[model samples]
Target: MKNEDQAAMLLLGVGGGGCRLAASVRAVYGAGLHAVGVDTDALANRNAAAGGMTCLLLGGSRLSGHGTGGDAIQGRLAAQDDMQNLQAQMNGVRTAVVMACLGGGTGGGSTPEIVKALGEMGIATVCFVTMPFGFEGQARRKEAERVLPMIEESADSLVVVPLDDLLKDAGEDLMLENAVNIAEGIIAAGITLLWRLLSKPGFISLDAEKLHTMVMRGGNALFGCGSAAGDDRAIKSVAALRGCSLLRSGEALKRANALMLGILAGSDLRLAEVGEVMCEVNKSCKPGCHVEMGTVFDPAYEGRIELVALAFESWTAAVMAVPKSETEVAAEPPVADVIPARVGGRKVRSKGGSKLSFGATGRGKFKGVEPTLYNNQDLDVPTFIRRGIRLER
Candidate 1:
């Protein structure tokens, strides 16, 4: 990749697990990768820094270099306190890939806040978060679930990786530590494929601009990869991808609105193999689903083929709004004719000129207090009443 392209992108790691994941990706990606890690634990921050990532300590004064100790509230507060420091690292970045593991304090609590802040800065964010394993207990799982919506609200594209599903594909007989490492390795390798697709020389390139556009319109995404060698390597790799739990056994592809497929193989890759891979993938997806494919050739991948895919479930078209002509505007239909109103548990046709308004309703107990205004709307009033929605009897 060009220096300008590298400068425009950032790989951000949040909390300890996130930092480790980022470090792993960096190791695979080699040099010229812009990376940073943030955590409430000073020791963890130092460790990430030791791995060549720029580290920032969150809640330094309040937490006193100690971690949140599983308290998500503290993690949230720490992020709030050091948010300015984090922003300082985002000097020239236009896109960020965030890595965080939910169910813990720093990852769960701070991720939403960080993503929100990045959005406000006009930076597009793609967040990859792992849900805790079931054995981790209900509390952690609940915490992760609660934090998910918050992160989704701010992230341009959200990819949720459930550790349980990830580990299930690995094997049942592995040790705990080894299983965790392998899971991380798998995720890191997938991310590395994406980076390589952008950075490495390719027969067909997937540029950063294409990624930015797709991500901005792609809401929720699914990422998975598979590799195979020897005869029919391309077809076999795609078959393995079909069985990947991360993609819900190829169900994600069937339901996807858009797909970004990357193929990495050696110079010996055949044109027929590429055609076959595309043919099989096209058959799996719905008609007219937006698809982008790129291929990279590397000598190291001789006799092997690896496929990485990102499926976007909620992809929207980038249609530009065209101003209506004066004649067309004059012939516009009435709002009542276009939008049906729901009344008495059913849709009802209303007269075109009928106006619906809700006057100020008296507050129950705090009637005399100043109204709580949000965006110039009174928050003190009932939401439905404020919006002039007629409730069913």
Candidate 2:
């Protein structure tokens, strides 16, 4: 590997699903890219080599790489034990990307912990994760929801793709394996374009620091990757991007306050084509939005154009810069009443994992129901209501 390869962005895949994605990304980008796949299952680690990326087998003593048997705690412990080795892979990389599919044990259990570990390194981390399909069962879906907030808290920002949404438009004759393979290819292509924008600079030159500000300073985001070849490829590529299911067919883009676009084109890319793409982007966003643009000229895409666009919520540029009107100005967001932590109850820690230790807790209006643990908080009936945290519309 060249010095460029060693110091370029790092892509880390966690668990079986993530390893497959890492492999897919490696196959497309080839040299000048470092990819690593970590898993508790030795078999998953082995099978992940379809594209020949580095693989790490974790939890040799406890799981012996036999697999976590769909247990998240085991998956988490496996990654925890091998954390030093995993962190070593991130050294010197400009940025780190994590890929994982939630719902199963290893992906769900270890993803948040892995994000937390990357956070400790003070590197800008972005995660692209998948939620379980509606048909995948309540247990998996619940598990995905359980750790989602934690993962968001750990990573700078993340893009979540629900499996059901991804699979909704599959053709009737498409086999499940083929559908998964197709999705992985698309994902790999997107990852390739993103790193190209950072490591391989073009005329506009968006560096690691600028890319960091675009991603890390925003809320959760929507990402889409698409490509087109032949006449008017730039316009066609942006159209393809707006049509991807992962981006909710661009409905999310319309609501976003912060947007970043990375374009990869052949040496023949024209200025007019660039202008057309920018026009489409400006038309899509409302006034007061922040847009970042970067382009890379690659001989590999000589006759084609590829685009990777990310749309995210921004408090500074969008929310604060709302349009003004003399007659009726926008009012500030409503503040809801605060919920009390101590509602006439004696707080006591539970001895084991099977006990509720709140004594004589008076849950104001919820009437009858036991307190449940959410985000590491214990509370009575209607936890959100009792906690006084109203959900914003």
Candidate 3:
């Protein structure tokens, strides 16, 4: 597959918080893409480089000390710095995607700033970020609560993933690495959808403006399978998805491509039943077309069965690659390669270890919140959080 549009990927991370995220993006999508690291802490730059992000900078003000007084001020200043830098990067790219850990030091703080800058420059921005797990603590939660709204308000479209909920299946025995894998899987799933629409041959290849429009309209449409208590079986239904409305909304699930199916089962469901459900789902789709099947289950539920499906158009589908070897390379250094080796920038610092004083600022606001995080309070509780940019409220 070959991509005709010039796309630039900006990988932002602060400290080791963004390490796995940056690494995950590289692991799934390889070289010829630019990667830049940003952090006020030197460690973040070092780790991002190790993770394969080429550019690392220390533009965000470093967080020091403790307590939650006016610490938000420093965050606002950091956000401002991030916005300035991001504006410079949006120079020639038609599409820009940023992958970062939302509840940490650098990435968390500067992400909103960058988004605001891009928004002002008319560049489309999509963010893939994780919230802190409930068990982390209040500090993280407060931090997340404070910054998330600010960040969400600035971006064209924001996709906030709740890792704790997504990986609950990993169970109590899960390790940190396992948690990371789960996060990456969620990230991969989100990006893969976009990649399919833009990179494939049959789907629509969206530009920055169109991308931004969809994002502002709540870009992602989610589907999941779940079973209820008392049902001792798995249910699979074959339904043809007929339409092209989804693709127009940046969802990319049309009728011409293979159908997207989902499965859900309860504790009582037998292995045979599960097998039968999957087989039926596979057979329900159009022949000779590719099908992407997703599944989920809960052992505690007594009797439950769930199946979901979506479709995509063939003409608008894309299967293109970065075309690193063929596309004419840019003369200037790619944004990914510009992150500093160490975390030290000309950004302002706070007086006390806990906060900084950014002379003056403005108000900030987000039109509509996405379903992934903003609308669900149960999911909104910040498991982790770090501060960044500030603007007019």
Question: Over all chains combined, what TM-score does candidate 1 have?
Answer: 0.80
By lDDT rank, best first, the candidates go 1, 2, 3
Candidate 2 local lDDT, 80-132, one digit each (tens): 99988887777686567899999878888889888877765556678889888
Report the error of model 2 at residue 53, Å. 2.6
Q: Which 10 successive residues of model 3 have the least lDDT summed?
A: 342-351
| Every candidate's lDDT | 0.78, 0.71, 0.44
Cα lDDT for residue 144, candidate 2: 92
**Weakest lDDT window of 10 consecutive positions for candidate 1:** 342-351
- Which residue runs does candidate 1 get wrong by more than 4 Å? 198-201, 205-208, 298-300, 319-393
Query: What overall lDDT, based on C-alpha atoms, would model 3 receive against the true structure?
Result: 0.44
Q: Output the lDDT of residue 316, model 1.
A: 39
Ranking by TM-score: 1, 2, 3
Candidate 3 Cα errors over 4 Å, as ranges: 1-4, 8-16, 60-75, 201-216, 219-393
* Candidate number with the higher lDDT (1 or 3): 1
RMSD of 2: 10.6
Model 3 Cα lDDT, one tens digit per residue, 1-393: 423342443444433455456566556556634445555555545566676675445443444322112244554455565555645655565445666565565556666666566555545565656667777777866776677766656543455555565566456888887777765764554454343333332211224332322333333222222222333334322221111111222233422344444443444556676565556555544455455444444352346554433333321111211223324433433223222221111111111233322222311111122211211111111121112333457
